[model samples]
Target: MEPGQLRVFAQYDRDLTLEADAVVVGSGPAGAVVAKELTDAGKSVVLVEEGPPFVPAEYEFDGGLSMARTMREGGLRTTSGTVMPTMQAVALGGGSLVNSAICNRAPAFILDRWCSDFELERTTRADLDPHYEAVAKFLGIAVTPENVLGRRNLLFRDGCDALGYHCEPMYRNVRGCRGSGECFTGCRSRAKQSMDISYIPAALRGGARVLTSVRIERVLAERWRATGVAGRVVTPFTGRPSHQVRIHAKLVVLAAGCTATPVLLQKSGNLANRSGQVGENLQFHPGVAIMGIFPELVNPRFGATQGYQSRHFLREGFKLETLWAPPAITAVRLPGSGMALKNRLADIPYSAIWDGIAVCNRSIGRVRVRRRSMDPILSWKLHPADVSVLAQALWVLSQIFFAAGARTIVPGVHGIAPELHSLEEAEVLRDRPIRATDLVLAGNHVFCTTRMHGDARLGVVDEMGRCHDFENLYIADTGIFPQCPAVNPMWTGMALAHRSAQQIAQQI
Candidate 1:
């Protein structure tokens, strides 16, 4: 059968029942990889997604409209304990559809720490190297071309060089990038190698079916073995349940995501939380942005969204990177009102934006399931040390801008001085008591909610992504990460999914 002939669950008018050798309850990088691998090995697979399949033409250039169409909770999902908004994509390809497209492999130090701290002996760098290579090749990963590195990225590089800090062009998973500076919104040119255009299509060609606009309500368990899943199709516009869906399979893979996967399990009466680790140990790479005003026209909105990142502070649990957003997003996040904001918007062409991402957050969070709607409720609080680190990172970012000859620096902090004109004023930011509410914080990467460990009491899954309580249930998302990987977790998450597929293939 042709790939386009695969069944879409939402098209059905009545209740449906399907059978597959494996059922994967997500369509992100991890779910896509798992579905593709299982089908390629001659197993019937069904990939379910809670979001719609967005064609390239349907993607919008406007940030607000794009977020409303693609992001979870219209990009307004926030934590309860802190003011940090969690930005996650809700589409067929998950965050890969809306991320910066940066693809960094798990750092060697992080892998070593996982092995030593979590006893993830099977997840060593050497063991996962081939999987990483395969994923990179499949995604067409390459360094952003220097010619396309717009003025904002160039300014960041200059600042890093002036400070003798180590910085390099980021490797991205794009094949024919046009430097549109719209990766966060969604790549309209089909240049971004997201899973929708990569693995999902391949899986379809291998006879795998995809069910979009459907939420997996629960995994059907039979005496500690996964039997399949039951869920309902949701209306694309209103996001309300419509048609009932039930799929029977020999195995079940939960790749929904860090936030949704645990919520699903909890709402299903904690099927996989025998060890009580279903929704614990959440770690997000909290980040803050700063804009530098340059004497020359920086034109931050005209190139790669994120082209370069500095590793100078990686050991300090933070990384500096250049970023860009459309005028609408940039205007709202500029930290001003009416006239002040208008003036800043007028100077958009001369401003360069960058972010210092705190990768080593000790602040643990949780994802609770709401009883009525089954939606996820996130709770997180920044550790005291994390607050200090964030302030230090902002200070460092200001210093970098000054070193790069910025005319003025607009720190994105809430109550801090609006603009720092000199090194002395920027230095004062280092001593200011920055509260959790004083900074504009956001995170896209979340992990460790259903972490993997050899010991059952320590984690919900094993090194191979198998749930400790169920023999045939598996998790193949960043939600199983032992801790924050201190880098973009896309490549690492895919590699882990590939490993999980291999293990499952062997078992079947």
Candidate 2:
């Protein structure tokens, strides 16, 4: 399909099928990059996605409703007997639509560790620097400016300075962003530079067709060669039901994120045992929040969700990032009954909040493909080290609030009231141990389920992002990230997608 060409619809009842030189599943950051790269190399491409198309300007600025429509499984519920909530976007732009605009590359120290300990070659930051630079330029990545740091973000930086914890404004992917603080619910101004606005648009302009509201079930394989896929396209408006449609292609690329990609490989059956590592070693950078009462109207919802982050404790297995939520969401976390509710609601606009995100250095999980349900089973077990890291990070955050002259500070743990009044009160929190379920955590940065590596026995994909036992099939999503970066995972995911796309373009 070329630009400005006629439309092509794939209907199920008509046994309508389409053939292409390459088929890309999932229209997020990875798939968009892959499709554009392949098509630019003169290969015909077709992209399939399961969620509705989102025009950034068309989406209302409602957090809850937008999250329900764009996020997967209403933000996947962990089945690991822990309340460790994690969320990911399922729309055409994938997580890029519902993520904080912060765009940090994978930390250098983490990459060094992966290469040194895991023996991953050609995976160093130096080797990937050109790719990162290109991606950053394409997304228009830039650091948050001082003028855009709203009062709440300012307070976070001021508190960090007072407490001797280093903090600086993080970089973001945006063009003329007005600091609306609505990144979680999809950028309403269309300035946030999500994949929908950047890569996907460029891909479509380069003559690639994207089909929304299409759910890919499995990769069609024959004699270890992945020829195409079998799936369905629901009615765009009603979404009642539809028949099946199979797509034949010379190449298949999987960009279905950490959960879906692994399950697809496992469900394919022929590809599972070959690597024997699909759906294993899932990693999530669990996040938590802290709120402090301020004398002025801080309006925590005015700037970037995570503009400033603390790097003081990065070596301690914890990374602190500043974040806040909408009034309704934050109200549910505040402590109180009668008098407390009255006091809290009155200070909702004035409350100063900062999220402390912990990128666990040791926690691991698994995603199992259930035969009965199409959705994959998600399970995460928190390690002892993760719990200890949470405790240390919380204590540090509390001390910073106290230093900043906050009289009351609320911890993110469930059922835990504000624990700090004076510096003396904050000292007691350092002694308290945080349990796995006690800490409230939710992060969308997940990876490693379908990790790529040099050895096939330990991972699902090779370093080139190709599946082990299948020819002409590749995984380009975060699932192929062998190690989870201590910071946000989008930049790393996009860069790897670009690399994988180049490899596929060369072969085809």
Candidate 3:
């Protein structure tokens, strides 16, 4: 069968089978790029996604309902160790549909560490710069302009300036953003260059096919070669497994993401476990947010959801960034419910939330698959050392808030005072020993579930993203990173996918 049109499994009444030159799983950043590049190179490609296509106009505006509609597990997926919440988008565009569109390249230090520690060399800046440039140009990536940095985002710069630390506008994968601060709910204006609006459509135009609402259950393989994948169609509303699907192809690219990909591999009879690292070495850029109530109207609802950032403390194990969420979602985490919640909700416009993303590069974790179930169980804990880093970050944020003329700051640490009335009160947290359970945290940037290495015994895939055990099987997602890139993973993920797709094109 030729690859040329979009296919929605929900519309099918029976089993479906397809044949293509290449089959790419998950229509996220990595998979979309791989599919587009292969199709652009004249190969017939079929992209399969478990979730339906991301439809911007149909997105929920309220944060709570938005999560219910777009996020996997209704945004309730949490870590097994620390019990902190994490989010994974379930749409065709994946997290890009809900993310703030921050686009950052991997730092040189991270690349060097991967080269030295993980037996990687082809991932060096010299080898990947062109690919990164290509992806950036296509996505219209650039530093968020000042005009879009409304008062809420500008305050972050004010705080950094007052403290003599440099904070700059973030590079975002967006075009003509209107500062609606609605990035977390999906960009209704189609301004954010999410995969669905960019590469996925481009791939369709290039004759690549997409199948939505189809879950891949297993990999079909013989000896050392992958033949295809088999899965079931999913009913959208009830999420019931309905009809079946099978795709035969010469190449199979698994980009099911860091958290889900390993489970997919395990469910496929533990493929590529020679190194015993399919779901091992999981890492997260865990983040904590502090709310600052300004003396005046900071208008939290109006800004680029997150447009400014401070990477100055990266060596200190965390980086600070501005953040905002709808009042409904933010209210659920407040102290109380009834009128007390109403009072806090009234302060929404006067509050600004800035977050600290703990690099946690040295912290280790894992994702385990249950024997009887195919669901991935995340097992991660905030290390004591990383806990201290977050404490310092919170303290720094308090100081920054006060520096920017805020009256009081909410630290939200369980052991500490609930509200620090002044900057002097915040200094006590500078040396406070924070336990892992004392703070409410969340992580969305997950990495290293199937890392790449030069040696076949040490990693699941090679630097080129080909599985060590099979020439035609590839895994092109954040799972292949030896470590978290200490920033947003989308840009690096796309960069690597671009290079890997080129490599595959050359091979075929």
Candidate 4:
């Protein structure tokens, strides 16, 4: 069935009530997978999303407009005690609609650690292989074609090779990609195979209904069992509350990403946080970028935004990847004022940027609900060890840039020299006392806010993602990850949701 044939309610203005065997909050990767799998098993499902449906034609390539219409908090959400921004998309497909389409399976070591730490004997890598394979096949996951790798990506690969480090082409869920380097904004060509184009459509075809522009305020429970959800429909353009809405289902699945899920549960009078762990242990793959001034034009915005990555330092809690953004976002990250800034803007075509991501950081954060409100108060503090790891990553990125024949490198650190000409000068960066305020940090991956474990005292859900306190309530997002997966969490989160859906089907 075509997408147009799906039952999507986007502009219902009157009070409404929906009923299903399972109602999934959030139409992201996890919720889409769960809905599709359950519908495939002949169960009725309803996928609810807080944001409106946006097609590729609606994308105008304007960063500010895109954020205002599709992103959470108009892309201005930040941690309470720090300047670090927590990026999350609030569309029908959630982050999958705006992300770079990178797909990576969880590493074996990370899976092993999760199994041991969470006592999830049934969640071994072997147990998850089939689910991962299914998701990959469904999404057409493959190594990005060599022709689409832009010059910036090749430069990063050349630098890694010159330094005897390994860099590989990233796997993405795209077909016929034009390499427009606009994935961070929505994909205007619709070439990228996001959840909206893949799983959600399949679910819709298989009898699942999707309701967009509906905010779920609370999960309705009766006698320790999830009965439904209640909320209101908001105006698509302004997000102003408009009409009351309710969804009653035999089972409820919460897949509203890391931040929204915990906050929703907490705001509902701690419905499923029996262990006091609903909004704790939040971890993110915090990343910082280094810009190299090359002599020739790089045209960073001409190809796939992210096409290559190096995990050579994965065990050390960091990874390296090449990234490109539109001139507006790039200018915001570039440091300068007056003439200095103007000069850098003019040199955008000659600048090459790559990110050093600290994936296994020990930093811990939390999400708390403000009294009498649905908003979340998020806070995170980087540990000393994690700060040192970021410093090491900076040193490594500088070396790679220099090896690739960059004349000057600009480490985007506050209270430091703007430009470094030699490795000796870059060495000073390794010793500088790194502070969260001194670095430009961004995180899109969030996990472990409502972790899953066998021990109810330490986790909110069990190994199968079923809430320990309620038989009919389950979680199917990265928020239930036992620990940080040390990689892009999309594929793993979808695979876990598939498993959870299978479990729920068997019980039903």
**What lDDT tens digits, residue by residue, belong to model 3 across residues 1-508?**
3457887754778888999889998988999999999999999999998888767667888887889888888888999888788888888888888899998888888788899998887788877889989999999999998988888789889999999987889999999998888899989888999998999999999999899888888988888899999998886534679888999999999998898889988888788778888999999998888888888998777779899999888777788999887777766556656886678777778889899998886678899887755468989877888888888888888888899988877777888876688888888778677888888888999999999989889899999899999899999999999988888889999999999999888876
How many residue-pair clashes does candidate 1 contain? 0
Estimate, for each residue in 164-190, the C-alpha lDDT of model 2 and write its tens digit: 888889888887767788887777778
- TM-scores of the candidates in the order shown: 0.97, 0.94, 0.97, 0.97
Give the alpha carbon lDDT tens digit for every residue of 1-508 in model 1. Answer: 2332444544668877888889999899999999999988888888888888888788888888888889878888888898688877779999899888998888888888898998778788898999999888888899999888888898889998999989999999998888889898788878999888999999988888888888889888877888999999887746888789999999999999999899888877788898888999988999899888989887776788999998788788888899988678886777678888888778778998889888755898888887777568898889989988888889889988988989998887877788889889888789878898888888888999999998998999999999999889999999999999888899999999999999888777
Q: Residue 230's C-alpha lDDT in candidate 2?
A: 82
TM-score quality measure for candidate 4: 0.97
Instruction: Report lDDT per candidate.
Output: 0.87, 0.76, 0.87, 0.86
Candidate 4 has an lDDT of: 0.86
- In the range 1-508, model 4's lDDT, one tens digit per residue, is 1221343345574898878899999999999999999999998888888887778787757778877777887888888665588778888898988899988888899889899988888887888999999988888999988898988888899999999988999999898788899998888878898888888888888988888888999999988999999998877767678788898999999999999999999877788887999999988888888989888888888888899999999998888988887678877877879999888788778878899878644788998987866567888887778878888889899988988878778898998888888778888788778877888888888999999999999999998899999999999999999888888889999999989999999877
Where is model 3 more than 4 Å wrong at Cα? 337-340, 371-373
* Candidate 1: residue 204 Cα off by (Å): 0.5
| Candidate 3 lDDT score at position 79 | 90
